[model samples]
Target: MSKPALLVTAADLAPQALALLQDFEIVYAGKTPQPADIVALARRHDPVAIIVRYGQVNAEAMDAAPSLKVISKHGSGIDTIDKVAAAARGIEVKAAVGANAAAVAEQAMALLLACAKSVVKLNDRMHHGHWDKATHKSVELAGRTVGVVGLGAIGRRFARIAAAMEMRVIGFDPFAKDLPDHVRPVDLATLWSEADVISLHCPLTEENRNLLNAQTLSQCKRGVIVVNTGRGGLIDEAALLAALESGQVGMAGLDAFAQEPTPANHPFFGHPQLVLSPHIGGVTSDAYVNMGIAAANNVLAVVGKAVAA
Candidate 1:
């Protein structure tokens, strides 16, 4: 049998992850492929399948590759890919879900802890020998109420950690099925009204974008801390900024943003009450390897074995 052809458009996979594709006739590109270029490459190569991450796949990209049978994603979020277009042409779509769940969950906790204790502020103060500890008051997590705004793998894991810390944990997930004994299922309104801290862990769907706006922020308890480890569009930065400025929100820890490589003057750049990260929730070495291998294995399963549902 001839070697199968595969196109890997997402180039951030680690070296170990790249080495796993030794069996395929792989064509790699670091950025989103241009329509004309992808068309010519697909026509010339006649690839069996293509794997992409964080790239748009519209009707044009799909129609150009008649030989393409499957489209595998390196990450859990498939919102970037046009699934409707792919299905209209009979191309199977698969994603490596739950692969980076643990990494994201842990990072959320890291952010929450950092915010609760004012970790960054104190460290910066101490480094300058200003000893501003007199004015800084660190909050404790022990008896606070924490609300998780999604019950997927990442959200559930984060809830478990919060429960272990003796915090009152409540969750809101429309699709929630199996929840632990400690986590009580509640409506979004209840979660917001009661939680001392609220963490967002939902996808960037049309209905969910800007879920945390002025109206929703008004429902929360005063001096609430906010954390976002999932998609950035779920929260409105403008509303968050206003709340932060007015002291309605005590602090925020954000690992993702509306735009990556967030501009230097972005509202969050020097916000004293905010801990901003450059979408590094899943950037750990272990997460890189796991997601990479999972993405590569998904390709093999779909193109070589017709596996992966």
Candidate 2:
């Protein structure tokens, strides 16, 4: 009898995770596969499980895979996968939650520090032989208030880091019941009004889409620094740009954007106050390995395979 087929929709998987699926016939799709490619592959392979990393698993793709029982996300975010559609088809959708929490939290702090110290801006100016030190003033993180939007694994870790730096840490998460000792629980309004630095760590949902828009931005303290390692849809780009221009928002550290692979002519490109990175906050080697293992386990568990301890 032929082995069960498994589809991998990423460029590669960890060696340890791949070894566990040796009993299955693996079909590898290149990273960032198009929607049509995914559907076609599903139809061709008749896979029982599909592991998605940086691609979409929409209704069309799910419908094509008649045998698919499980869809596993390589990381915590499931925005790329259509969970509602999968649920309708009776397909189990799972994520590797907390597999990359530490890595992501570290990245959030790195961005916060970069913005507070004007690291990128100064480095660029110095490279161009511009020695204007007096104009470039950096804020001290110690004694400042940091408001964390989410108190999940990543958010709590970031809060701990902030507290270690002697900064006051506050958090806003409606679902979170137990918060760290260092992080004071506060409402969204209090966060906006009192926080000198605001860091977003929540998943993007309909209710929180464009959470940092004109009205919310207006409520924030003047010259506040913002850091977002979470979803791009959490902030309104146009509104943020306007705030940055008017000096209401002193600086922004963005790892995710409203659009993936942000367009070349996007307004944020030349802004000196913005420090940007491609959405790689949780792409560290350690995180990749952990996520891969967790994703593979989820797939195996859903398929009734006895996952080795």
Candidate 3:
């Protein structure tokens, strides 16, 4: 009997994950995991399981692989996968939840501190042989309020870090109860109005797409700093741009964008008050290994269960 096929959508999996999947006949897809490429790979390999890192696993891909028993996400977000389609086909879907939580939370904190201290702008100015320290004002985190949009693993870690800095930490998560003592729970309205800094840690959903829009920005404190390490669709970019121009928002640190590999002429590019990083909040070496291992384990678990049945 032939070994089961295991397809890897991206080529960057850690060696540990590759070693663990040695029992299966591995099929390496494209370096960049596009939806069409994934579909083509599925059709060619007829994989029993797929480890998805950065592609849209849509109905076409699912339909192409008749042998597919499990779809595993390398990270927590599953927005790119068509869960509805997978469920209809009786395929189990799993995510490596909390695998990169610490790494992402650290990145969020790094962004927040960078925004608060005007780190990027200062570094650029110094490199250019210009010093204009008097013009840019940095705020101290102590005594300020930080509003965390979610209370998941990442959010909780961020809240704890902020609290350690002596910043009052408040959070809004309808689904999360029993928050840490240092992190206060508040309504969205209160969080918007009172927070000096707002860090988004929520997952992207249809209902919360563009959660921070013109209307929501207007409700925030003047000169409030916004940090987003979550999905880019959570903020309306146009609204954020307008708010930055009008000084409604003081500064923004963005790790994710509405569009990946944002166009060269994107309006946010070179914005004085904005700090941008390619969506790499969870791409650290440690996170890569952890997420890869977790994703592989998910596939093994699901496949083992199927075999037993």
Q: Model 3, stretches more than 4 Å misplaced?
A: 133-135, 305-309
Q: Please tell me which model should have the higher TM-score, number 1 or number 3.
A: 3
> Root-mean-square deviation of each candidate, in angstroms?
2.8, 1.8, 1.5
Residue-level lDDT of model 3, residues 152-192, one tens digit each, is 98899989999999999999999998888999899999999
Q: Write the per-residue lDDT of candidate 1 for residues 1-309, one digit (tens) a residue.
A: 556677766555667766877666777655656556565666777677777664456667777777788888777777666788989888888877777888999999999999999999888988988877568678999999999998888899899999999999999999989799989999999999999999988878989999999999999998999999988889999999999999899999999888766788897888899998878787777887777788877777766564221
> For each candidate, how many residue pairs have backbone atoms clashing (under 3 Å)?
0, 0, 0
User: Estimated TM-score per prediction?
Assistant: 0.90, 0.96, 0.96
Candidate with better TM-score, 1 vs 2: 2
Checking candidate 1 for backbone clashes, the offending pairs are: none
lDDT of 2 by residue, 66-174 (tens): 9999999888888888889999999999999899999999999999999999899888889999997777678999999999999988999999999999999999999
Alpha carbon lDDT of each predicted model: 0.83, 0.91, 0.92
- Residue clash pairs of candidate 2: none
